[model samples]
Target chain A: MTAVSKLLRRSETAVLAILIVVMLVIGVINPAFWQADNLFNLLRANVVIGIMALSVLTVMISGGIDVSFPAFAVAAMYLTVIAMNAAGYQGVVLPFIGATLIGLLCGLANAFFIHTFRMIPLIVTLGSASVVRGLLLGLVGTSIINIDRMPPSLIAFGSSTVDIGGSKLSLMIFIYLGIAVLMWLFLTRTMAGRAVFAYGDDAESAKRVGFNTRRTVYLVYGLAGALAGFAGLLHSSMIWLANPRDFVGYELDVIAAVVLGGASIFGGRGSVFGTILGVFMLTLIKNSLIIMRIDNTWQGVVVGCVIVIATALTAWRDRKALV
Target chain B: MNKLTDFRRFVNRDNNIVQLLVITAIIFLLMSALEPHKFLRYYNFESISFIFPELGIVAIAMMLAMLTGGIDLSVIGIANLAGILAGVFFTRLYPAGPDAGAAAELMRVAAGVVLALGVGLLAGTLNGLLIAKVKITPILATLGTGQIFTGFCMVLTGGPAIVGFPAWWGFIGNGKILGVAVPLILFLVVAVLIAVMLTKTPFGLNLFLIGTNPRAAVFAGLRTERMVLYSYMLSGTLAALAGIVLSGRTNAAKSDYGTSYLLQAVLISVLGGTNPAGGKGTVLGVSIAVIALMLLASGFQMMRFSNHLIDFIWGGFLLLVMVINVLRNRGR
Candidate 1:
């Protein structure tokens, strides 16, 4: 009973309970929401954003917020496609690797500015986001790569599916899940991960305790960039197009998801499981609004309300605990 | 020797303003030298005067919010919603007929302006309440509220531009008084009021103290919450003023209008020497920074550079400023 009560008290449990309630409500309103194909589609939709949320989770856990990952992702995906077309390289691995490295370099730029200058991560990332996006659109090219120009191997890889109960699920969904599991392990089982949490809780104490704060910052941001790059490429593949303007407004959505998952905006408090649940909850709401026959225009308002209420509740709870 | 030292102290104290003035001068000289005829035109300056005020106002609003160690990401949303609501008001009630009297038209436009400013105040108050009362982080709260405001805009407009504002309303955006643009005059008045308020008033001092150290401010018996709420409300009103200027200038409002201004506002505020962490900024520095960037932008326009390239340059300029500020701080 005590164990069950403790489980019930966990933040992730609250998110899970709320998510289930939301899903049931949506399902009751629209039976089509329960369709296997629609559910699979929701899972597939989760792949890109889910991966991005994991990246954000890492950054949030390390006492930093990155609004630049979307820009990095789009830039990597666009540039990789351009390079593939230029070199006539069709292999999946090389392109993915290239995109990840590009993202890492961009992430390193953020780390360098933030760590060296001790600048606020938000402003540094904002500056870098603009620079990367402007460079991508201005110098590289603003044109879209159509399906005809997209590498056949990449498209094929994107289309590959796994059979589950005779319903086809995109292979990318599995990859997303795999990445999430790996992230959970790394965050829980690794010393470096503990250092990230330590730094987030109190940077000065973490430093006094002999953690390599610089390396942790780099690792956290670098991994985030690499994941964002991978997700960007995956997004393009799934959509079967490479547009420089893709993910123009995804930063907020990803951040909102991470925060919704019970992560403190101030850092040092969140879980991988909660983040996954948060992403799913958000994805479900966004994907099912049409099915629920709600006006599409209300989407932003609904999401905004959810964010405010959730954060306010958490704030109130924290204040209560202090009292 | 004493006079020289006094002058030096003055220069050091207002270092950001001095640097911005030098940058502004350099930009002005470069633009004039590069395209003497096009860049130095009387019409060019006039057009910029009309346009820069809206942006300048929004930047100042951003500065105020940053002064509290907070940010208002919803400024653009508030601006657009204010304009759209006013536009909706004008379209709904103000009749377009020969029978309509000038007084009635003026009254209607006045009501519409109030409604717009009211929307700004309400939206800003909501942001303030969320941050101060609910105790949510400022950035996240503003981000959420910005979306809500934008969503309301979408609901009202349903994806098309709202047009048909009264003819008299255009004066707010484009009219001239004493050979000076009305918007420019409004901007000047606002700049002076805010500068005085920031430097000369207890509210302003309290804000700076709160931003510098919230715990200390509280310990000193300051009502930090109320001050933050008022600052956000003021910021919201300023944003609405920008919205009025914008819709007036264009004679239309839309959900996505001035989307690019959001980034530019943040950039200009920081470039103007407002510390993002809060507690320090000035109207003069922000004003000069806006002018410098505007000059640079107009010069690039003269050179026939693409808008994308201009955006790239702006981003590069922000990074350069960041690096310079860091180096300067370290030197100090």
Candidate 2:
């Protein structure tokens, strides 16, 4: 009984329960939601968001928020796509490498500003997001380039599906799941990962404990930027277009997903399982809303309300625990 | 020793104001050299006057929230909603008919203003309640509310701008009073009133105290929660006023109108030397900073720079200023 209570007490348990209920409800309303084909498609659709949520989880776990992820991702992906088309670089590896490198450079810049000035991450990321977006707009001129013109191998990889008895699954699902498992391992097994949690819990104490706080900050933010870049590649593959404005306003949704996954915004509290669940929950909400025939315009309302309510409930539960 | 003290005081007091003046001068000179004919004209300055006040008022609203150690990202949302609600009132109450008299026009405009401002207050109160009562982090709370407010604005207007306001409504936006733009006049009045309240009122002092040291304020018997509510409520009302003027000037109300103003307002507030962590800012400083930015923006536009380039410059400038600030503090 005590073990059951302990499991139930975990915040992620509540989120998992909520997600299951939502999925069941949606399945009941639209029987097609449970179809194997639709389920696989849903998993493919959520890969990019799932990847980005992991990146956000890393930063949030290390006591920071990076709203600049979308901007960095868009900038890196756009540049790579533009360059690949210009140079006629056909292979998938080169584009991924280029995007990750650009993302790393941008991440280093973010780290430089945060380390040197010690400004609030929120404000710094906000500024950096604008700068990157503005640079893209100024240089690229808001043009949407079609990735369909790219190498056939990359497009095939993006669109390729495998048959399993009767259900087809896109290659992107395995990629996202692979990344999530790696992140989970890193967070649980590595000393550097432990340092990230300590830094988030108490920066000064982490420093006192002889952790290289600066390097941790750099690694955390750089990893996030790199993952975002990878996600950008996947996103372009999924959409078959590299538009500068494609992913600009979805930071809030991504942040909402991470927070819903039981990561405290205050820091030092989150898990890979929780983050994946959070991503799934948001994707479920979005898919269910569409199945319900709700207007696309009202989507923000639902997401915003969910974020506020979830955070409020967490705060209440924490307070109750204190008493 | 006395002379050194006086010099230090001057350095501390005139720092941001001096920065503002120098940036403004550089922009003015650049514009003069680039667009000698058009930039020097009286009409150009008048047009700038109309444009700057809407941005300036919103910046001031942001400044007030920052002074309370919180940010109100919902200012733009509130501004848009206020304008939308007022637009609704104008279209519904007046109906844009020929039989409407001067008296009806007056009533229509009056009702519109009141309703818009009232909605602004309600939005602010909601923010206050969430932040103070629910104990949610201010940034997250406001971010969520801002999204919801923007969604509401979109749902209300059905994604199209509401237009056809009364003819007299133009007076608030475009009219000249003794050769001064009405919006500029209103901006100054609001600035003065806010300046006085910030400097002279007990409420204002309590706000600063709460921001700088909430525990100290609470231990000193301050009603910290109520003061926080009051601060956000004031911010909301100011955003609403800006919205009214903005919608009136544009002669339309839309959810996405002035979407860019969000970043601009935060840029202006910070450029004006308002501390993001709160407890330090000045109306005069913010007003001067607004002008400096407006001049820069006008000069950039005249040079045929794209709006995107201007945004890049603003973002770069924000980072540069903080770098300088941090360096200066370290040196001290």
> Individual DockQ of the candidates?
0.62, 0.60
Q: What's the distance in Å from true for residue A156, model 2?
A: 2.1
Q: RMSD for each model, in Å, please?
A: 1.6, 2.3
Summarize candidate 1's per-residue lDDT along A56-128 as a digit string, tens digits: 9999989899999999999999999999999999799999999999999999889998898888888888888
Clashing pairs in model 1, backbone N/Cα/C closer than 3 A: none
Give the runs in model 1 whose Cα sits over 4 Å from its true position. A320-323, B1-6
Question: For all candidates listed, what's the TM-score of chain B alone?
Answer: 0.98, 0.95
Candidate 1 local Cα displacement, residue A123, angstroms: 0.9
Clashing pairs in 2: none
Whose lDDT is greatest here? 1
Worst 10 residues of 2 chain B by lDDT: B89-98
